[model samples]
Each structure stands twice: as C-alpha cells, then as structure tokens.
Target: MSNEPDRAWWKEASVYQVYPRSFNDSDGDGIGDLQGIRNRVDYFDELGVDVVWLCPVYDSPNVDMGYDIRDYRSVMDEMGTMGDWEGLLDDVHDRGMKLVMDLVVNHTSDEHEWFQQSRDPDGEKDDWYIWREGDPDEPPNNWISLFGGPAWTYDEGREAWYLHLFDEKQPDLNWENPDVREAIYDMMNFWLEKGIDGFRMDAISCISKPHGLPDADTGEDWFDMDLYFNGPRIHEFMQEMAAETYENYDVMLIGETPGADPEEAKKYYDDGVDMVVHFDHMDVTYGPGGKWSPDYVGMETLASAGDDALDEMLNTMDLADLQEAIRYWDEGVGDEWNCLYMGSHDQTRAVSRFGDAHDYHRESATLVATFLLTQRATPFLYQGDEIGMTNADWDREDIRDVEARGQVDILMEEHDVPYETIAPFVRNRSRDNARTPMQWDDSEHAGFTDGDPWIQVNDDYERINAERAMADPDSIFHYYRRLLDLRSESEVLVYGDTEYVLPDETYPNVWAHRRTLGDEAVLVVLNWQDEPRDVSGVEGVESPVLFGNYEQRDGTTLQPYEARICDLG
Candidate 1:
C-alpha cells in the first residue's frame, strides 16, 4: 500500500471570490455580466489563484442580491444568457483556473415557478415549500425573520402562512419532501455537466429545521437562531446531496455554515463536503448587542486611537478569542479541511475590517494577506482585497442592501432609536461596504464601467487601484501574488501542523505561530497594533526572513502592522 496520505486539489488551492455585480461592467449597463468576468480571467491568472468562486448570477429580482434565485438553470437577463455563461467558463478554464458557482438551495425566490405552483391550494407542488395554516392575526409561531420581521408570511391564495427565514421574497424549500430533494439534485447535476469545477454552498446549514416549529426561549424580541440553524436533519440532507451529486464528480464542495462549530463541521465533512467556512472567529469583536448595535467599536477607531484609547478598545477586542477559534478548528477537524478568509460578500472589506485602512493601508493590508495565506487551511481572497480595497463611504440614501434597510426600520419603529444613532453602526457593518464597484483604474468610474456605475466608486481609487498596484512592485497586489506563490510552492504551508508561539491572551496584538511538516518548519509573526513591538517567546530567532511588509527588520522586533514569514529549516 502507498504510505502517502490522500490529498485533494482544493486542499492546496487558493480561491478568489468575485461578487459578480460589482466586478466589472463591460456593456456600460452599470451591472457586471458574464462577459465582463470573462474579460478579467487574465487578472485571475496573474494573481496566481487556482479557483474563482463566482457569486450568484441566476435569474432573480435581486431582492437579496441574487440569493433569492428565480430559476435554477437560466442566467439572469442583466447578467447575460446561457451562451455568455458558457463562454466565461471556457475563458476561466483556458487560463488554467477553475470556476465555482454559488449553490443557493436553501430557499427560492417567491416568483420561482415551483414556489408559484406550490402557492396554489390544489396544485401538485403544494408541499414544495414550508406552509402552515393558522390565525391570520398571528403567525404560526413566534419565530422572527432574519431581516427583522415575522418569519411566516401569509399567502391569501392558499390561506396558509409560508415560512421565510430571510426576506419574504425568498420562501424556504421543504427539504423533507423527497421530490424537492430530487429537484435540487437534478439542478446540481445540470451545473456539474456544464463544466464548472465546484460549488460554494450558500447558507447550507440553514436547510434543516427543528422537529417542531416552537417559540424560542429568548429574552430579546428577535427570534433565536438556535431553533433552525444547523438543526435536526442537516447531516442527512448533506449526505444525500453529496451521494447524489458531488461524490460522482471530481469537484470541490465548500459549505458556508455560520453556526457550525468544529465538531458540527466534522459531521459535514464526514457526510461529503470537502471544506466548511465557520464564522466564530469573525465574531470576536462583536459587542454584547451583536452585529446591529452601536456599542461595538469600528476598525477606524482602532487604527487612529492612541495607546490609552487602544488599551480600552483592546479590552473590547477579540484577538484572543479569534486565535482560540482557529486553534480549535485546526485541532478538532482532524484530517478534514476548513476555509480561511478575512472578508466575504456579506461582510465588510478585509482591509478596512482587520487592517488599517488609513495611514498604514499598504503595510496593514499586506500583513493580513500574509497571515491568511500562511495558514494551513485554504485561503479565499475576496474581490478587490488583493489591491487593499477599503469599505465604501455610503450615505443613508446610498445604501441598497435590503437587510440593512430593514434593520434601520426596526430600530426606529420598535426601539424608538433615532436614525442618526444607528447610521454610524450601519455604515460600519453594512454588507454594502463590500458591494461597491471594483477599482480597476483611476478613470471616471474607476474603470469598472464606461457609463454610470451602480454604486459610487471609492474616492481613494486614484491612490489605491489595480492599475497603480500592478505597476508598483511593492504594492499590496504584488504582495498577495507573492504570498499565493509561496503557499503553492511550500508543502509545510499547505499541509503542516500549526503551533502557536505567542497565544493571543499573552500578547493580544501580536499573532505568532509556527507551521511544521516533518523536519521543515516556518514561523509567521504578525503585529496587529499600530506601534512597534518586540517579538518574543519564539525559539528560532536566527532564521532567514522569507517575506515581510517592511524592507528592513531588526530580527527581534516587528514594526507597526508588520508581518514576517521565516523559514526555520
């Protein structure tokens, strides 16, 4: 028998996520299409990414920005036709890169044919969605929607209330129905036959619900997610889907599981998915009020505050908590895999969230890139993060995300909070931050569109853009390129065991770890603060610095937001 352990291509490959609507608008329609993405395949090749996870481009009203999918096989008219999508696939494959489409199977747009049929009282597809009959004055249960309303929406036609965990435009599919599972499996097979490499399963864990749709025991008004998130039948559904589709093809499966822990994730891995994206590490800095409250401090505050101010902020920060979360997965997952990322379509920009987006933009951006790339898990680079994109400076009127607008309405109507009080928090944590147009150049609309862009381009595009970064050898773009190259070439980085040299609690601002594969080992040291700090607790100090943000390093200290990778072999 061969002694070598089995490995998959996705385990070692790096993925780049492209939010389709904001990537580029080639037709001057202010909306990015498949042709626009096809035009940018060369950029992906140059960046050295192995896979591109394209966000949803399916036919929809865009109520949740394409998450409310109207059709499974058809492309959106604004995005392009099936022909254009095929051409984009060819272009991606031609460049030696693979493309992964977003698989949104948890819910379907209310306008979807299946949903419309299911809404009919005597239709054959009546059981295709979750429906219950109850008093019109009150919902079936006390469950609240994720978008800040009642989860159940009454359908006058069927005289029933349909469950919608998200927007009312999106009705949750009844996975318990064998016919629904078969239909979803057929859709997956259709795409797999279309030549795409894999799928980035969106909200995969939310497919299952508790045995009884009971009211949650919570002190707050909002429904507790524990009743539905990763509930009773998650593993069964995933296993069935995997056995019917993913297992038959040589494709990657990445599940976006928000509430899944290391143990729960291992179950999914055993069922069939290749990797899971957990969100515990990302929630460290969230205050007691969660993501919507104004009590949490923003990244801009951390970057500009003084030592005393920073100390107070550090108390509220979750550096140690984040480190523990990563370590737990690294140890608990065993041979299974996990995905590493600093930002995504649903979150703020990585550079603006974890790195300094102000004076030390370049250094801090590169530091975060290096930290993520050197980890043992597969790293995903969000769109424009390679060029150090910052969050959009959007005003109240500029915001277009449905979730944000709903939250604002809830705060005003229910809590009696003034609009001004919550506007700052909305700006700091809105999904719109990562939904702005890509800054390709310093053109009228940052070279993203020839005509009017859908969202306003960042004003700093003149100083921070792909054109300038590609021209400069020391830019964040080139740093990311080099980091990807290093990961591709280093076996230790791809499959090594990670060991923390300085735990987060001991030195909260400094994240230091060592990755070891047999006799070969590499040390990664990153300073999360804005001030210089002495590096300690690491045994091997005489190793050569393989990569660093600063040109000159004293070997014993790291400059503000400095990142260093040293080969200890």
Candidate 2:
C-alpha cells in the first residue's frame, strides 16, 4: 500500500557489459564467441546481475573492433553463427536474466552492401551514405577524423569524398534519408522479435548531422565533434526510431551520448529513451586540449618509467573536479534516471584511471565498486571489473586496438614523433586495457582460451583471476557480490534521494553522501585518495557499519581508499 510510482524493471536492475572479443573463447579460436557466453550463465547469476549487455557480434571487418559492422542480420564468422546467438539468448533467458545487444546505427562498414551500392553514384542507394564533392587535398572541410585524419575519404568510383567520422572503413549512415532510417528500424525489429530485452546504442548521438557538412570552427589539433554530436535532428530521429521499433515492445534503451551535458541528456530522456551514457565525468581529467593533452595520463608516454612515473601521471587528475562533474549529472538528471559506470571497452581500466592499480589495487577496486553500486542510478559493471582487473602493461609492439594504433601511426608517420616517446602514453590509455581476455584461472592464457589470445593477458592474472577470487573470502569479486546483495535487499539504496554530506566543505579526498527513503537512510563514506582522511565532521562515523572494504575501523579516521556504508542511526 505504498504511494510510490510504478517503475520499470530496468530501473531496479544492474547491468553487466560483456565485451565479446575478450570475454571467453569456447571453441579454442582465441576469440570469444556466443557459445562461450552461453557457457557462463551461472557466473552471471552468481554475480547477481539482472541484464547482460553483449557488445557487437555482428559481421564486421573489425577495423574498429566490430564497431564497423558489415551486415545487420548476420553474425560474425569468428563470433559463431545466428544459431549460436539464438541458443545463447535461450540460455540467458533460462537463467532469468535479460540480454541486451549493442546497437550501432550511426554507421556501417565500407564493405556493407548499402555502402558498396552507394559507392556507385548513379545507383538507387547512392544517398545511403553522406557523399559530397570537394578537393581531394582539402577533404571538403577542415573537419578532423576521430581516428586522427581528415574526416572525408576520396572514392575513385564515385569521383567524390564520403564522410567517415571514425576510421575511413566505417562510413557514417545518412539518417537524413528516410529509407536509411527505415532499414535500420527493420533490422532492430528483427532482433527485437528474436527476444533481446533491450539495446545499448553505440555512438547514437552522432546519427543526426546538420543539413550541410560544414567546416569545423576549431583548430586542426583535436576532434571537432561539436559540429555533429547531438545535432539538430537527433531528438526527431530518436523519437521516430522509438515509434517504429520500440513502441510495440517493453524494452530498455540506453544511448551512448558523447559530448552531451546534463541539458542535452534530458532531451533524449524526454524523447522516450530510457537513459544515456554521458562522458562528462569520464572526461573530467582532460584539460583544454582534451584527450590529446599531457594533462591526461594516457597522453604521457614514459619510455622506461617506473611506478613513480605512473603515480605522477595519475596525480594530474583532480578529485574536486571529479566530484563536481559527477554531482553535475547526479543533480542535473532531475526526475529522469541515470546510468552509472566506471569502466568500459573504450576506457582504460577503472583502477588504473581512477584508483591506485599498483599499490592498493584491492582497496581502490572495492572502493570504486561501492561508489558505483551505492549511487541512485542503474550501474553497468564492465567485464573483468568484478575480479579487480588492472590495465595490461603493454609496449608498442603489443598494440592491437584500432584507435591506439591510429594514434601511434599518426604520431610516428605524420608528425615524425619517436615511437619510444609515445608508446607508453598509448599503453597507459589503450582501449585494449579493458579488452584483455578475461582472467578465468591461473593456467595458460589465464584459461580464457587454449589458443593464443587475440590480445595479451595481463601479467597479474595469476593473482587476479576469477577462480582465485571466488575461493577467497576477501577478494574483490566477493566484495562486488556483497555490494550487489546489499543493493538488491535495500529499497533506500535503489529509490532514495542522494545528498552530499559535506557540501560546502573543502575535503577533497572524502566522498560522503546520504541516501534517504521514507524512514530509512544510509551513509556512504569513501576516501578517494591513498592517504588517511579526517571524516570526523560527519556525524555517522560512530554508527554500525552496514558494509565496508575494511574489516575493522576506528572512530573518525578513514584509511587510504577505505569505503563504508553505515546505517544512520
């Protein structure tokens, strides 16, 4: 007999994002497949997640690690067949967990039939992609590609340049064309009918472009995403898509909106999109030069540096800025819900980026887990995060990610930068850090595959694998389970209002927030730094600890990277 509004299932559920290429390989092909995922349903149940979001497994050239998809209805040869996918879906459903597929509608591979047909200027599908006439040298405008070059690639067959916001092989779809939108909607419906619970739309903000492709107003050094990200027709297209495909079914929708602020995010929410993955908090470390500047850790490549060098790079990030960015979204979302995450395929490992991955890996990893789960939003836990996975210690020769390789090629080939000078920077920030094969056991290749892994496994796999974590009571994986259990059992954690404990104070190392429901409340205190912090000013330190990273605690003193969820008595 409560008066609270009825909420959707997604609002009360936690998501686990599985990057298929690195999750598990059942066929010994050194690549993760649908069968491998089907083989791990019990693990998902053990982890206590409600939804499993699979990254792209569609047919692809893998120029951008499956983002450059070649076919909408077909499965990748390496990722197994449509039969395997259907079987996997059935297995997930049998476990009472929902499966959400990654939706990549902004673009298609240059090898896609539509793009191939559009390559012919006189063909009926000529307008399927954005094509224009311009000087080959000028590239239609000064717009820089996200992969580090001109956005336009010249096509000899069409005698014109086609726009590719990512790698040249991934052509941006012309959503301005109604036929193109219809085709995408039909493909989505095909999957919806096949029993997917939802979709995690990839780079969805880039779908709508201005009427005319214009030159970037910014300089040539960085990306000019402002010109097209969350463009004019974005809301219209999203609404049309919802009506065409999602309106008929009860499903969740998560849009990956880059460069969107709180105000922009509300537009998607208003358009019936369930939630959005905004990058404001993720990009807090970027300086005026954005991701390419030395202010960011990934841009600093120390050729033979030690842990001290890495520590110095990590210190460039400001905790106050992080708090401000997080607070901006947390407060700005208003009645609309938010999606929370610490790491993903496109990001460096969360421990390496935001916590001390080397010295206090366990403490920092658990601390981040508490922060992610205790918030008033749906948490999406990336694969390998449960076992406290850290970034791979990679060198230039070990690089495989398309974006990292593109940066290296640009620095060394175009700018004559030394390989040694930029190699470490790329390693520290490579997307491959998160894409490393899952650490399942202490055996060869971390038991991800009997064959050689597509990417190198982390050297610390012997200590961080899942088998070891499951057996140890104090392991990071267990802490995640306990946190999820706490969330599932407490209504306040899921439906309460969050209020920062020390709003006007200057305590940079401490993050204290209270989640309060009608008659229940809990306080989450976290020390974000690797030093002892004075949280005595917070009145609830003496209260009984509901859950914590440390086994024992003393009054008012929080150890380095310590976290506590205390009942506010």
Query: Against the unseen true structure, what C-alpha lDDT does each candidate score?
Result: 0.85, 0.86
- lDDT tens string, model 1, 388-436? 9987656778888888998878766665656654555565578998888
Q: 147, model 1: CA deviation in Å? A: 1.9
Clash statistics: count for each candidate? 0, 1
Among these predictions, the greatest lDDT belongs to 2
lDDT of 2 by residue, 1-569 (tens): 13263477898899999999999999998999889988888999998999999999999999888999999899999999999999989988998989999999999999999999998888999999999886766678777778777788999898889998888999999999999999999999999999899999999999998767777778644766678698889999999999999878888999999878888999998887898998877876555555544434443344455655754574356766777777888889787888999999998888877788878999999999999999988999999999999887677888988888877777676545677766555656678889999999999999999898998999999988999999999999999998999998888888788887743356767888998887788999999888998787887876889999999787789999999999985
- Highest TM-score, which number? 2
User: Residue 58's C-alpha lDDT in candidate 1?
Assistant: 94
Report the Cα lDDT for residue 92, model 1. Answer: 88
After best superposition, candidate 1 residue 51: deviation in angstroms? 0.1
